[model samples]
Target: MSGKNVPFQDLFVTMTKVAKDAVPIGGLVLIPPKNEHQLLFVLGGTAKVQVDHKHSQPILAADTHFIIKPGQSLQITNQGSHLLDISIIACEVVQLSRADHKLSAASVKTFAYFQYETVSHTPRSLRAMVQKLQEPSTFIDMQKLLENQFLFQKLIYLLMDSHASQTDADPRHAVESTIEYLKLHYDEAITIEDLAGIAQLSRRWYTTLFKEITGENPSDYLIRLRIDKAKELLTMSKESLYAIARKVGFEDEHYFSRRFKQKVGVSPRFYLHNRRILGTTVTHPELMYLLGTIPIAAFSPDQEFPSYLLEAFKQVPKLNNSHHFDPEYFKPFKPDVILAAEWKDYENYDALSRIAPTFLLPSHNDWRDELTDVGEILDKKKQAHRFIRWYDDKRDEVREQLKLLTNNETVAYARMTQEGLIVFGNQSSRGKILYTELGLIPPEKSLLHIDGKILSVEQLAGLGADHIILQIGEQADSSREALLQQPGWRKLMTSPTSRIYTVGHREWYNFSFSPLSTGFAMQHMLQMFERGVVR
Candidate 1:
């Protein structure tokens, strides 16, 4: 089986399953298991453990022993300065499985390699031993196994006994040991002392080792772990922010906000609403589903959502990765009836027609009737009719529940508009793109965070704004050219006065959806705008 398939519960595979002093950060470990496991001997210098907190004491030498039989857990920490060598090893848990069980768990000794070096590059003695292990009969000979075990034991003993003599030694072992403890007990309040005990070393030694091995203080790593968990939750759950904060070991939402902002560059709410802050006029459940998954992915060059739909239809778990922009992102799956605004997009997903019919959704919205016409093309005119009824039900529910929030009889739909980037629709939610794929900031009155200094009419024209909305007009420049360039008299036109005020306003300012809705309207309006049937 692939490593990705393995469900890891608090355990990370070690790069080196068997290692020596490697490097110590001033701590020794003594893992007192609740169950029995193999008998393990930790040999190193001064160490501190957390069985008793508020202390960082010295560790005993090779003479100290802890039986790590099957189903048992062990810990050792060594805190020293210069490369203090500490030795750690795992023995067969079968030998001590049920006897006074004190270890954590008993399972197959699954090891992982983060990195490794060739035996030829090892010390002279280790090189010779490795070469011997490669001999043709090594696997068949029982004596060779015994000899190999004995040699490994001797090597660990030598590294621990003599190499771990300095106060500040290599701290990789201590760092790794702490990582192990953190992985196991993230849900609990863990401290340096607890980690020290795991490594059979002193608190000071453990802290030092943690830094040496991980290149950061232990506390920093813990925060990172918490932040990562928070991110996963934000994307997957509809949990309240306070609840999520508490779940991630943050009791205060405000503090969590600060930390999350510092780490992720966005607030929790933004991450959650990035793709889904939508207000729709459609109320029918089936219609809502159809519209939400509009299959308008005709030009989604990434091919992402199509494949995702294919897998979803097949009940496969989402296979997304951190690289969200990968080009082949959506090639893995296929979909039926892709809502194409353009024929080009239809061709893009045409490769999957053998699997299912990929048709386009009708793209007209001058009034609501076009929706039915669009559905009719898919041979689902009745479905479109039913949608309006479903929409009414949802609209009534919203009006009943959220009536106090607004004074208007017609509900206002707010969401990021594609043209205005972060703009929200001010009119009704029905019959338009209620949302786009952009994060929406909740409506709150505050000074615009845009440029502070007001630009004059001439300055506005220089900046190339289609038109300008004048708060008040005051002239600073006397030049006629400058006055002419000023936009103070310009009309910032919108849909209400679109055609009526054509002389003073620009045509593009008549708000509408993307080429999608506009093109749809154009197709339907062709006869009205230019008499007769046209494709």
Candidate 2:
């Protein structure tokens, strides 16, 4: 700012309110615009502000704030609620030059790219400053105002530091690096400890860190990456299942098929067969396009498949960063890459091969791995890596939490079983019981393309849940049978891992068995699992 009278020095700062009777100055013009920049700070309640034709989201609660350009359309609304208490601030500064050009008065532009689709680092500094101002104040002198503004600058510095550190020094960053390694070397036989060692962190710490970030552990996340890579080779390239398996870290094609079925929900044979390779392969550059294998987004195994494509798109180069992916608004595009996660979409994975290569991840696989596989197909290894690291991190976090819980003086387990099915007949918010809250998350929030149906058993498996109340409903009976008979179940049950303790013995499966009271039966079963009283 070469000008003598700097606009920043004369900034107006004040509290805004409407009159007692009328709309108590629900709005205010801080410094009646002589073409000055304005920044509105929300102190309390909700408000809607507009800049030119663009309206900001209704500012809710304290700490909400926004910046507007000179002559920008600005308005505030109480939204039929109590008049909001807000702080008004403004300045008319010569804009800073973005390029290497000197900061001449003619070349300067006000830094007003503060509006955000999300809480990003660029504007967070100013937002944090506003939030700090919203806190109860003591003295209000020019020095105090200057101090507050200085803190804003400091926040900007910290945001820059945090961003720089995340891409480089952050412990979670290793997961992403590992994904790139896996994508190129999916055929390599890698161990969890081996991957953790790549990051120079202890396995326990790596698992927790991985899970915290990526939502999947190292081994599981890596499997998805390998499977996806294998899909690309299996269909697009003329590789046998064994060759693909060997390339993607599986020692045997049979094991690969089992893992593929778990994660992709279809065996390799079914996937390749369902999706045809219509186009002939090109030799010079090896231009191969993978087709159809779409994961089904199910409302239920029985209901009609959702016509709605709860879609997302991305061109991410690595993890902890995304170029273009939105879970909110649905914009129609060819989806250069589309993820077909519905049973119907998967029927002809070959059809999509013509579009771009697509892979179907089955629900039987943990949702995180399924997500990672899609990422691998799109060459978004970093995102997958971040996810794997996050999951690994969280598992240890939960394990440590469980250890603390078990060590507590009076630990209790409220188990679930068929005979104890009556226990949860009428209850809300009781601790440590098997339950589902389908209504809590909308369709978009859910990982499964599912509606009301829930696979809490999978969730429990992931969380290392200690007990199951196996409700004695028709669904329960069917589930119990599957649990007892399934090979997957036998491996977990026979080998006593995951601290999974079933309260009742095999004898309680009788349809005629009845509990005197649902609550008491549940309580008794829970105690049995905890104390091994039933055994």
Candidate 3:
């Protein structure tokens, strides 16, 4: 009860009981007070224990222990995924007079309450003794009762030894205490040596253990905490950069700017404006560019840009290779914002966010909606709406021309790749322009919803369309020649009722998805219809 050690003759233990409990995930265990003290040991898993329904403290497996006083209620919760296993030893303790070695009647009657203390990292021998108490026993037998009393005495001795060896306790407790201190005083002027001294560990050992537990060295962790606080201030308040720098523990604004850029990939001023944008998808860069701002870097898997945007993006650095974005490769660019499409690797979002504020855009069937969302991110809502209106007006102009040119004829769009011939659906880039915008009918209703499907020669022969627009790939000339030699190709070409038009695969594939590219695709399709180059 007191910090001082109780003499061996000054205490008596009786009615000792040991119970083991298993609490499942998200389960709660309540231990009612029976006018007896308890020694709670976490055998496995972790638990949050609250005394009398007050604030709780975490008890880690095999590393912490609590001595609950008599008449104290306990509320234990298992917040982790696994079962929380704990052993509670309850016993009645009577005070004895130290001088005469006899029970103190007055002390027993008064039962003065004392402060409760936690004893961490008890000796290993105490675990075996507690486990022994869990064995089946007949309490009515006097021998068993005496055995329990003797075991309790040994347990008390082990507890005393734990208290005596406080200086040699687990270093984790000291390190954890230091971590709490750092969290509370992050903005204060603190040194690594001071933290190590507070943790009672050598500087090297302290840093090693800190990194092991927190995944960051002390300096980095502290700096990150300060930077996070600075970000909040920057967003919520109009504090001068120098004032913010001083408030978040940096003495110089220049040093703060450098650290902020290193951690956040942008200066404070750039963060507010989000000026230097990075695009993680091909469409994202085009959308941003159409919104009147060129991305600092963009994904260029083949080191090629859309023909319509090539001149504008000729100076932008490529951020990805073969459609794969490496966060390390783009760190030096220091973008203020990153626009990523949902099709990119979901796992890299966190890493990308660390470099800059990253927004993951979901796949939208309509490129206009994607542009509007990007506009919201860059605060260019008006530009996005204006572009959509321009596209709609252009689409209307083309749709009227196609109404007279095609005269209700069915049209199918296809692309020739090295693999084979693939047809596009109404929802696809080129397909949308042909079917939705220009109001062309597909040979079958199923093609209206199909995104993209590969067709064998047999399937191609059965496709009953008035006209077919085939885009030829750069390296698929041989494949195209082979297809032309097939019987299905000959039959389709010979049909006087059907017409076939050809276009460049590079021009159509790259310039068919984003707002700007879709506009180009419309003009390209109209030109092909006017030229009427049947194959």
User: Best TM-score goes to which candidate?
Assistant: 3
lDDT of 3 by residue, 1-535 (tens): 5422244444555546789999998899999977878878876677888876545565656545777877677888887778887888887776654543322222221121112255467566677777777777785877976887788777766665565366346786566656765664576777888777655689999999999889999999999988877775664456799999998889999999999999988888887665578777767777888888889977653447767777998898765445554765668987656777777746577677777667788877678888888888777889899988988898899899888888898888888889898899886766777787778899999888988899976676577788788888657879988998998888878877778888775456555577666677678777878877568
TM-score of each: 0.28, 0.25, 0.59
Error of 3 at 48 (Å): 26
Which stretches of model 1 miss by more than 4 angstroms?
1-174, 180-185, 200-209, 212-215, 251-258, 261-535
- Model 1: per-residue Cα lDDT over 1-535, one tens digit each: 4442332222222112333544357544555443322323333344433322313333434334332333334455665454444333444312223332222221111111111111101223443443343334444787866666666555433323332332125455434634754643354466666556645577887777787777877778777767767765664455888988888878799998899888767887774443221111111111323434332122221123232234432332233222223323334443322233332333333333333333334344432354564444444567667765665464344434333322221211111121211222323222232212111121222212231233343333333322112211112124333433435424312222211111111111122432222223223222222231111
True-vs-predicted CA distance for residue 94, candidate 2, Å: 50
lDDT of 2: 0.43
Give the per-residue Cα lDDT of candidate 2 at 255: 90
- What is the alpha-carbon lDDT for the whole of candidate 3? 0.73
lDDT of each: 0.38, 0.43, 0.73
**For model 3, the run of ten residues with the poorest summed lDDT:** 105-114
Residue 36 local lDDT, model 2: 54
- CA shift at 338, candidate 2, in angstroms? 6.9
Clashing pairs in 3: none
